[model samples]
Target: MSNSPKKENLVSIIMPAYNCEKFIKDAINSVIKQTYQSWELIVIDDGSRDNSVGIVKELLNNDDRIRLYINEKNQGVSATRNRAISLAAGDWIAFLDSDDMWERTKLEKQVTFAKKNNAEFLFTGSSYINEDGNYYQGIFDVPKKVTYKKLRTHNVISCSSVLIKKRFFGSIKMEKDDMHEDYAVWLRILRTGVCAYGVNEPLLIYRISRTSKSGNKIKTIKMTYKVFRFIGINPFGSAYFMLKHIMGSLKKYRRIKFIN
Candidate 1:
C-alpha cells in the first residue's frame, strides 16, 4: 500500500482577494500546478475595485476545482475568510493569499508530513518576493515545533503557509480584521493545548507589499498590542509581549536580503 494520502484528502484553499489583480492570476496558476490533486480553491473577492474578479472568472473554465464568490461590499479579510470557511467542504483547510504563490509540491509534501505525524495544525517556512515578484536572498525559517507561548513572542507561521484540520474550525475562526486576524486565530487554537508542527522548508512564496498593513511599522505595533489584549492579556503583560514582538520583528527582517 502506498503511504501517500488518498484522493479523499481534499484540501480547501481559502483565498481572500482585494485589489490584487496584478498577481491574482499567477497565484491561482500556482494552485493549478499543485502536485496534490485532491483540493479545491475557494476564492472570495472582497469588493475589489480592480479586475481581480474578472481574472478569476476567466480561469473557471480551465479547472472545475476553482470556485469564486464575491462580497456585496468591502468586507474585511477576517470576515471574508470566515465566509470562505463556511463554504469549504474539505477535511483539511489551507490558506493562500491572492498575491502569493506556493511551491508545486507544497500541498503534496505537507499532506504527507501531516499524515505521518498525525498533526492537526501545520505550517511551512517561506521565501520572500517583492511587489514586482523579485526574489529575496534569505528564507524565513520556522522552528520544528511551536507552542502557544513561543508563538506569542513571535509569529513564525505565515498565513499562506498554514494547513490545518477542518474540525478545528468549529471553534477557531478568524476575527478582528483591524488587527492580526490570522495570528489571533492561530494563538487561539494553540491555547487549547495543541502544538503546531512546522516544516522549515520555503514552501511558500510571500510577497512583500509596501502598501500592506504590516509594512506600516507604527500601525503594526498598535495592532500587535491589540492582539494580546484580544487574547485576554493584561496591559502590563501585553506590554512585555509587545516588546518581545518588536525585537522578534527586527531580528526577522534583518536576515532577509532583498535583491531589489
Candidate 2:
C-alpha cells in the first residue's frame, strides 16, 4: 500500500433494480455517500413496472458516478446483475441489491481489510430492514475464513455485502437462475480454488419485505437443491445438506425444533 495515487484499485459496484421505486433513491445515494471513492456504480433496470428507472435517472443526473441500463424486457434479477457485471470496469467488484443500503464506511472498511490482510475476496456483515425499513436483529455465526464445509450448511455472503477481485467474476460466468444464483456463482468460484473470506462487521442494511422473491420459502428450498446440484455434489449429500440447512435455519431463527 503506497501513499501514491494509482489506478490499480478501482472498486466497481454492480446494483440492479427492478420495481423498487420506494427505496431505489436511498440505495443509489448510499453509494454516492461512500467514504471510499474511486468506484463506478452500474445500475441495471430490469424492466421495472414502477418508477425505479426514473428515480435512477434522477440520481444519475445528479451524479456522474451512476450509470443506468434498462433491460429490453423483464429479465430475471440474475440476468440484470450479470449485465451490470459485464459493463463494470474496476479492479475489484461488488454487488448491491436495489433495495439495500450501505453505511457510508462500508466500502472503505472492507477495502481496508482486504488490502491489509491480502484477502483478495471477502464479504462484509449486514443488517436487515423490515419491509417498512425497520431494523431486524441477526444471529451471527460466520466463520472468519469460509471454505466449502462452512458454505455447505448455509450461505455466508449477502449479495450486497460482497467484494472480490475482478479476476474472480470474469473466470466464472454466474449462472442465470433467479433463485440462489449468487450462491451458485460462489460455489463455482470456490471450485476454481479461490478462497472466500468474511468481515464480521455489519456495515449493510438489507430491506426484507414479504414481497421479495427470495422470501418465498418454497422457492428457496427448490433453489437450495438446484445450487448444490449444479456443483456436481452427490445427490445424497445434496439432500442431506439441504435438509440440514432448512432445519438449521428453522431451529436457529424460526425456533422450531425437529426430531429425527
Candidate 3:
C-alpha cells in the first residue's frame, strides 16, 4: 500500500470500537491496505475492556494518518461515532465498523463514483461473513440511486459501506439510544433532499455474530417500528412500512441461509 499523500480530496474514516479485539486487526489492516492514499482513520475506543486499544496503538506508530481516541467510560456506538465525526478533517467521511473489513479498492472506487455522479451520500453493496471469518452469501444488492421515498419503507444502507460528504454532519448527527441509529441518520439525510447512491458492488465484509446487537431478530423488528415512530410517521403509515421492512428482512435472510 502506498502511503504517499495526494494534494486534494482527503477522506476521513470513522471507526467506533467496543470489545472487538478479535476482529479489530483485520479492520485496521483493511484501511492500511486501501489503494486510495489520501485518507485518515479516526478510531474511537468506547471504553473497551480488552486489548483493542493496544492493537490500535501498535498500528498507529508507523502511520500518522491513523489516530486513536479513548472514552474514559463506556459509551454507545452513536456517541463514539459522533466524537470521531467531530474530529474529521476531510471533505468526505467514510465509516468502517471495528468488526468489518473493506476491499483494497473500496475507497478508490467510491471516491471516483461519488465524484462522477456528484452524490452527497453513497453506500456500496456488502458480502456477509460469520464469526469464524467464513464467507457467506452476498446479501446486499444496492440500487443505482435511492430516494427519500424509497428509503421511508426500507433502509438499504450499510454502516460500513457508506461514504458521505462532510457538509451534512452539522445538521444530521446520529441519534443516541436508538437501535437503528444508522438507519435513522440515513433517513434524516435523505429527507433533506440528498439522494443516496449505491455502487452495486460488494466492497465490504460485514460480520454477523449471534452476540451482536443486530443478531436478535425480534428486537430488530421492534426497533425498526420504533424508528418509524421516532421519525414522526403516523401509525397507519408506520404499520405499512414496518410490514414491508419485516417481509424484506425475512426474504433476505432466507436466501442467505439457504445458500449456506
Candidate 4:
C-alpha cells in the first residue's frame, strides 16, 4: 500500500447525539477543523429532548459534509451507532461521541499511521477533560498492539479513537446496551485472529462526565462482568476475567489526573 495520503479514501465519522446541546457544538467543530478533509460526519440524534438537533442543523448550513438524522424514539447508543453505520458511504468508519473532542490532526495522523502500518482496525491514546473542558493531568496510553486475550482483561480502546475499515464490520454490530457494547464488538472482531493496532498519541480528548455510565464505578464493574459473559465465557471464566478487569482498572485510573 502507498504511504501517501489517499485523497479518494472517504471516512465516515459516526456521532450519536442525545441531549448533548452543550458539548455537541464543540464535538462537531473539532471535526470541521480536521486536517484530513475527505470525510463525512453522520450525526444521529437518538430522540434527544434538548436542542442537540438544532445545533447540528445550524452547523449543517455551512458544511455539506455533515449530515444529521433524528430517531423517532429513544433508541440506545448501540442502535443509534448501528443506524449511522448503515447510512455511512465511506470505506473507512471513524467514531466520535457527541461529548468528546478530537485533536485537529487526529484523523490525518491516524489515517497516515494506519496506511503506514497497513492497519484495518486502529485506535489511539486519549487525554481527558472535565465537563468544564479543563484538561486533566495525564494521558491514557495504549499498547502498540492488542489481541482478544489482552482486550478481555482490560478494554483500553475508546470508541472515539477508533478508525476501522467498513468492510471489516461486516455483520458485527454493537449489542447489549447495558454492557460495554463497543468492547463486545472489538472482542468479536479480534477473536477472529486479527490484531488491533494502537497509536500511543493523545489524539482523542475524552470528556469525563460524572453523569455518564462509565463514571459510576460499581455500575461499570457490573457491565464489565456482563461483557465477559456475553462473549460466551462461563461463570468461572467470567469471574476470573472480572477480577483481572477490576485490578487493571484500578491501576489504570491511578495514573489519571482528575480535577481537584
Candidate 5:
C-alpha cells in the first residue's frame, strides 16, 4: 500500500459477487493495496453456489478490515447491494466488483478531489484489463458538472469506480430490475438534487474474459435496449446507440471478430 494521509474518514467498499473465483482475490488485493487506510471492504455473496464464498471467508479470516456476508439464497445483485449498504457504517460509500481491481493510489486521488471540490458524489475513469492482463481504456470527457441529460447518452461513471456519500444510500437505493440496475441507482441519487463529479484520471482496472457477464452479445444488446427504455428515452434511441456500440465492438475485436 502506498502512503495516503491518515484521515479519520472511513469509506465502505461494497461488492456483490456470484461466482468470481478466479478474480475475487485480485479484487480484494486491490482494496488492501489502497494507499488510503480508512476503508472497510464489504463482500456480499449473493448465495454463490461455488468456491467464491469459501474463498471470501478465508480472506476475511485473515483481514480484520474485511467483512463477508452470505445470503441464504440467491436474491440478486440489487438485494445484495442494499444489504451491504444497510450494514455499512462508513461516512462515504464506494463500490467495487469482485472481478475488478484498482490502483494503489485510486482512493487517495479520488478522496483528495472530493474534499477539495466538496463533491458529494464522484465517478472516476477506468481502463479494461483482460484475464491475462491485456488492457484497453476509454478516454472520456470529464465535465465541469454532470447532469441527468449529460449521463443519459454517455455514462462517464463505471459502477466499480463510484464513490459517494453514505447518506445518499438512505434516500436512494438500487433498482431490482435486471436492466441497468447500477445506472438506475445513479439516476435515483441524482433525482434527490445532488450532482455527480467526474475524475478525469483512470484508476480502476475493469477485467473481462469469455466467462464474464458482459461477454454475451445478446445479453449486452438486451441490457442496452433496456437502459434507453427505462430512462424514458425513445425506444428508437437504442437503435442508434446499439449501432454505434456494435461498430465499436467490431473495431475492438478487429481480425478475430468471427471467433470472438
Candidate 6:
C-alpha cells in the first residue's frame, strides 16, 4: 500500500486451453491488461479442433509475453497444466483458465498480499459470470487462511485466483485424473503443513458454461468422490467429506438465489 516501489516479482501464468475459442481471447486480454507487467503466460492447447489456437496465435503476434504450446493429441486439463508448469520460468506461478478473466490489478494486489502474509499458497475470492460475461450473483466467501482439515470440507479456492510460490510445486503434482485435479493438488499442498491464504477480494471472473463439468451436479459430486478416493481417503471419510462439500455448495447457491 506504500508509495515505495515493490520488488518486481515475475509471475508465470499457466492456462490450459481446449475448445475455448469463444472465451480464450477475453482470458488472454485480461493478462495483457494487468497492472503488474512482469508476467509470462504459458498457454497449452489440448488439441482443440476449433480456432482456439488460431486466436491465441493472433494474440501472440501482438505480445511477446504470451506463448503457446500445442499438444497434437487431446490431453486432460491436469496434463496440460503440468506441461505449462514445466515451461514456466518465473519464481511465482499463477493459474488462469482459458474461460476465466482477471481484474487488471489481480496480480499486482495478490503479490503484495502474499508477501505481507508470508503465504506460499494463496488464492482470492472470485465471482461467477455467464458465458456472455454477465455477472452472476453471489461471489465466494473465502477465509483468511485454510488448513488441510478445513479444506477437506470446503474448498473455496478458485484456480484462476491462485498465486503460489513455485517452490511448493516440487512436492504437489496435479494428478492426471479427469476431475477435481486442482482440488486434489490443493489438498496435497495443505497436507504438507502449509496453509492456503485468501486475499478476500473478488479479483477474478469464472465463466460458467452450460457444458462445463460444474454445470452437471451429479458429475461434480462423482468426480469429487473419485478425487477423495484417489487421494487415499477411506470410503466412509470420503463420503462424509463429499456430503459436506455438497451441502456447502448447496448453501452457496442458495445464497446466490436469494441475492438474485
- Each candidate's number of clashing pairs is 0, 0, 0, 0, 0, 0
- TM-score for each prediction? 0.96, 0.90, 0.95, 0.96, 0.83, 0.94
lDDT of 3 at 208: 93
* Residue-by-residue lDDT tens digits, candidate 3, 116-153: 88777889988888888888764678889999899877
lDDT of 1 by residue, 1-260 (tens): 11333434989999999999999999999999998878889999999998999999999777888899999999899999999999988889999999999999999889999989999899999999999999999999899999999999998889999999888889778888889988989999999999999999999999999888888999999899999999999999999999999999999999999885
- What RMSD does each model have against the real structure? 2.9, 4.5, 1.8, 3.2, 4.1, 3.5
**Candidate 2, lDDT over the whole model:** 0.78
Worst 10 residues of 5 by lDDT: 251-260
Please provide, for model 4 over 1-260, each residue's C-alpha lDDT reduced to its tens digit, 9 standing for 90 to 100. 11233434989999999999999999999999998888999999998888999999999998888999989999999999999999988889999999999999999998898879888899999999999999888889999999998998889899999999888778899998999899999999999999999989999999999999889999998898898899899999998998998998889888888667
Q: Sort by lDDT, best first.
A: 1, 4, 6, 3, 2, 5
> Candidate 5: where are CA atoms >4 Å away?
1-8, 137-144, 231-260
**CA lDDT, every model vs. true structure:** 0.92, 0.78, 0.87, 0.91, 0.77, 0.87
- What's model 3's overall lDDT? 0.87
User: Candidate order by TM-score, highest to lowest?
Assistant: 1, 4, 3, 6, 2, 5
Report residue 222 deviation for candidate 4 (angstroms). Answer: 0.6
Give the Cα RMSD of candidate 6.
3.5
For 161-201, candidate 5 gives per-residue lDDT tens digits of 89988887776678645576887777667766778988876
